[model samples]
Target: MGAAGDMSMRCVLLALLTAAAAQPEGPRLISANVGIIQVDCCFNDTVVDHGQVVFNLPSKCLQLVCNYGKIIPRFLGDPGRSHCCEFDGLLYAEGAELAGHCVVMQCTRKGWIPRGDIDDCCKHCSVYDDPHFVTFDGYRYDWHGYCNYSVAQTDRTYNPEAGVFSDFEPCFGGPSCLGRSTFKDHKHTVISLGHSVFNLLVNGDPYAVPLVGAEPVRCSSKVHPVLAWRNGQCTMLLGSSKLMVQHCRHRLDVWAHPTHADNLDGLCGHFNFYDADDFTSRQGDVHPLEYLPSTFPHSWRTLDQTDYRCRQCKSCPPPRVERLCRADERQLAKYTSICEKHLGSVIDRTEGLEGYLETCVFDICMMYQDRRNDREVQDWLGILQKNVNMAHMIINLRLGE
Candidate 1:
C-alpha cells in the first residue's frame, strides 16, 4: 500500500504540474503543500502571490485578487453605469442639455455633442473703418462722436457681477480711427490696445506677444486669458469672450459668448438676435432711425466726459454734402466693388452690408471734403479693405469654420 500509494501520488502531482504549466498565461497553481495549493496572478509580466490584492491593474476601473489556485477580478464601481459630465463644478447627466458660453451642447456617454449650427450658439459685433458700428443684432449705424463711449455693457439683471465695458479713443489719421481701445471683463481682466499695433496691455501691465515659442501668452489666475499674435493680427481670449484687433487698421472685432446674448447693452445693441430694436439707449429706451447720429450715441457716453483725449467733431457734413457724396456714381461704384470683394460671402449670411457701403462713401467724402485725388482715395480704400478682411475673419471664427 505504501509504495503503490507514493508512486500514484507522485504521478498525480506530475499531472497537476503539467496542467498548471499548460494553463493560459494568467493566474495558475505554482506549488502544492500537503492539502494546500499556492496560486499566483500574472499582470503585465509581474507575478502577484496568492491571497494578495492587485490594485494597479491595466484598467484603473478594475482590480484583481489572487485567490487559492484562481484569480478573481472586481470593478471599482458598476461598469455598465453611465458617468456624468462635470462643468463649472456642476454635474450633468447623460443626454442633458447644457447652454452657456454662447453654445448649446448635449452631454453624452462619450462626451459633449456641440450644436451643428454655430449661429445658434454664438453672436458677433464689430466696429471698424472710420468707426462704423455694427450691433450684435446686426443694426448698422454711424456715430461720429469723439467721446469715450461704452461699446458694450452687460445687463446687470442677468448677472449682477458680470460686466464688460469698453472705450474708444479717437485717432488722428482719418475722420475718426480707433486710436486706443480698452476692454474690461467681469473678472477685472483688462485688455488695452494702444495706438501702436505692438502695444498690448493686460490688467494695466504690458503683455509680450509671440511668447518664447509657438505657445500663446496666457494671463490671469482665475479666468483664462490668452493673447496671441499671428499673421499681423492680435487675438485675445478672456473667459468665453474673444476680441481681435486688426493690425494697423485698429479695427475692433468682438465675439461674445452665447450666455451674454440678450444681456448686453450700449452701442453693441441688446444682442437679442433682433435688428429692429438695436437702437436702444443707455436708459433702455429704443430710439427711431432718425436718432442714430445724435440722440442715440450721446445717450451711451461714459459718465465721466473729462478725458482730454475725447475730441468731438466740430460739425458733421451737411445733409446736402452727404447726399452729393452718395450720388457720385463713380466713387460709389468703387466703394461698392471693394465691399463686395472682401465681404461678398459674409454678406449673404449677416446684416449691415449696405450700412458698410454707405459708411465707406461717407468717410471718403469727409476725408477729402473738397476735391480728392486718386492717390488719397486709394490709400483710404486700402485701410477699408483690411478692416473688411478682419471682419470676415471674425465671422468665420465665430461660425467655427
Candidate 2:
C-alpha cells in the first residue's frame, strides 16, 4: 500500500513535469491568455428544491476552495514547471463555508449555484487567498514555497499525527496580500512567458474556440498580473498569460538565486531551481518584513544557520531519505550534494516546456476553437504532456560574494 501511494505520487509528479515543460513563451499571464477568473463563472441553475449550488468550472478556474472530507492534492510546483512533489508534508484546503456532507455525482457543467460560501467544495487544485496567511506568523508564500514548504504540506494530511490546519487561518486578501520575495537582492525583474490550456477532447482541435470564459462573453485582455506576496519593501507579483507564444516557455527557473537576510522564514517564499536564500538582512533598508502570516514548520530549517534570516527548526526529511543507504554512512553528505544539484531540475524542465506550450497549445487556442479538430487538439495535449512530465528538479545555484 505504501508503494502504491508512492506510485500515485510519481504519477502526479509526471503530470507536473508535463505542465512545467509545456511553459508558454509569451507575456506573463494574459487575462485573455491564462490564470483563472471566478466572476461571471458559468454554472447551471439547479432548480431542484433544496438542490446545492457549486461552481462547476474546471479545476483550473478555481484558485481556492473549501469543503469537508479529505483534501485531494493535485500538483505542487512552479506556475510553469514540470517538477512537482506529492506534498510529503501535509496539505490543507480552506473554504468560505462548509456545507453538510453529501455525495456529488458526475455532474459537469460550468457555473455556480447557491449552497454556501465558495469554500464548501473540493477539487484537484485549490487556491489560497494569501497562500502565506495560513501560517502562524505573517508572511505570504510563492508557488514554489507552498509546494516545497514541509510544514504547510504536512498540515494538509488527514492523519492525527499530521494535525489539522484549523488554526491555519482562512486567507481572503487576494494573491498579492503576502509580500513577494524573489531570488537574490529583491530586485524586480519582469519575465515573460506563454500560457496553455489543454483541450481534453481528442477529436477537437487544440486551437478550437471557447478558449477560456463563456463562448458569448468576450475576454477584455489577453493577460493580467496577480500579486502573490509581499516581502518587506520588496513586493513580488506574477504576470499571467500576457506574453507572446514564444516566450511562454521561459519558466521561473532562471529566477533562482541566494540570500542570507533575517526574514528567510521557515521556507524562503522564492522557491524553485534552488533552495538558496537571497536576502541579506531585513534591516537592509531595501527589504522589510510585513505583518503577514508565514509562520512555518520547524522541519524547514535554513540552508545556512548563520544567515540570521533562516532559523533551523524541525523539518521533515525528503522522501528519498530511506533511499540513502546507512551502509553508505556518507550518504547524508551525498544527499545534500544531490539535492543541491537536483532540487531545481523541475524548474529547468518546466521552463523548457514553456516554449512548446506556446507553439503547440496556447498560440493555436483560438484556431482550435474555430477549427474544432478534436484529434489534433488531443495530439497537441499529448505531445505537450509527454514532453513536460518528469521526476524531481535540478538545482544549480552558484554562490556569490
Candidate 3:
C-alpha cells in the first residue's frame, strides 16, 4: 500500500508542474485549501499583487491598480494633473477653443496651445485727459487744436465702412478736450457730451443708448454692436469695432478690428503693429517722431469751409518744452510714491508705467505753473489720480478677456 501511494503522489506532482510550465506566462494564480485564489498582475516588467495601487505611473493624471490579474487605470484628480487649461482665472476643457482680445487659444492635455492668427482681433487706441493720444500701435502723444479732426478714417478705396471724427474744444481750463465724436460706419452715429450729459444721434435723428438696428446699423444692449450707457460712460459698437466715451473725463477709446489695419489714415495712426510708422499723415506720408508735436497732428486737421471749427486750425502754439514740465524733485518723489503704490502693477502690465509717471510729473508741474491755490491744485491732482485709477480698472476689465 505504501509503495503504490508514494508512486501515485509523485506522478501527480510531476503532472501539475508540467501543466503549469506549458501555460503562457501571465499573472501567477495560487490556490489555497480554503478555496481562495490569489492573483498577481505583471505590469512594465514588475509584478503587482492584486488590489495593490501603483501611484507613480507615466501619466500623472492617471493611476494604475492591480485587480484580478488585470491592470486598471484610475484618475487621481490631482491638482497638479489637470486635463484642462486655466486662463484669466477660468478653466477651459481639453479640446476647447477660446478667443480673447488679441489671441486665440486651444486647450490640450498638456497645456494651452495658441491657435489661429492672433492678429485677427481688434486693437485699441485712446485719447484721454488733456487730449493724450495713444495710437493703435501704443504711441503716446498730445495734440492741442480747437477743430474738428479726423480721429480715424478708412480709405474709401480700401473698406469704405469706417470713419471717426472728433471735435476738440477748450474745456476744464485745459488746451483741448474732446467734446463730441462722430463715428461713420454703415450708419452715422454721433456722441455728444456736454455738462456731464451724453446724447446719442443716429443718422441725424435722436436715438437713445442700447438702440438696435438692422444689417449695417446694429446696436444692442446684449450682443455685439452694442450701444449702452452705464456708469457715465457710453459704449458704441460698430461691426467688430467699439468706441467708448467717458463723460466728465473727456476720454475716448477706440477699438478697431484688424480689417482696417493698413487702410486707416487719421490721428489714430495706421493700425499696423509697428508704432514707428504710426504718425502717417492724412496725405499718406509716414512722419518721423520729431513731427509728432506739430506736423503729424496738423496733417489730419479738416479744412471744411462750412465748419467754423475747421477754419480755426491755424498754426498751434509753440511746442511746450517737456523738460520744463518736469516737477521738482520733492514733488516728483511724492507723486512717484503715490503712483507706485496705486498704479505700479497695472501700468507695468499695460507697458505704460514710465509714460504715466511722466504724465503725472507733467501734470504736477503744469498745475504749479498755473499758480492755483493749494486746495485747487490738490483737487486737480485728485482728479488726475481718479483718472489713473479709472484707467487701471478699465484696462483690467477690457483686456482680462
Report clash pairs, candidate 1: 101-258, 102-258, 102-259
lDDT by residue (244-349, candidate 2, tens digit) is 1101111211121122112222223322222232111211222333322222222342232322323333243322211111224363444334322422344345
By TM-score rank, best first, the candidates go: 1, 3, 2
List candidate 1 stretches off by more than 4 Å. Answer: 1-119, 156-174, 211-232, 240-248, 304-306, 309-354, 370-373, 397-401
Error of 1 at 176 (Å): 2.4
Per-residue alpha-carbon lDDT of model 1 for 114-146, expressed as tens digits? Answer: 433334445667777657777777767766556
TM-score of every model? Answer: 0.56, 0.17, 0.56
| Cα lDDT, all candidates | 0.53, 0.23, 0.56
Best by lDDT: 3
- Tell me the lDDT of model 2 at 274: 27
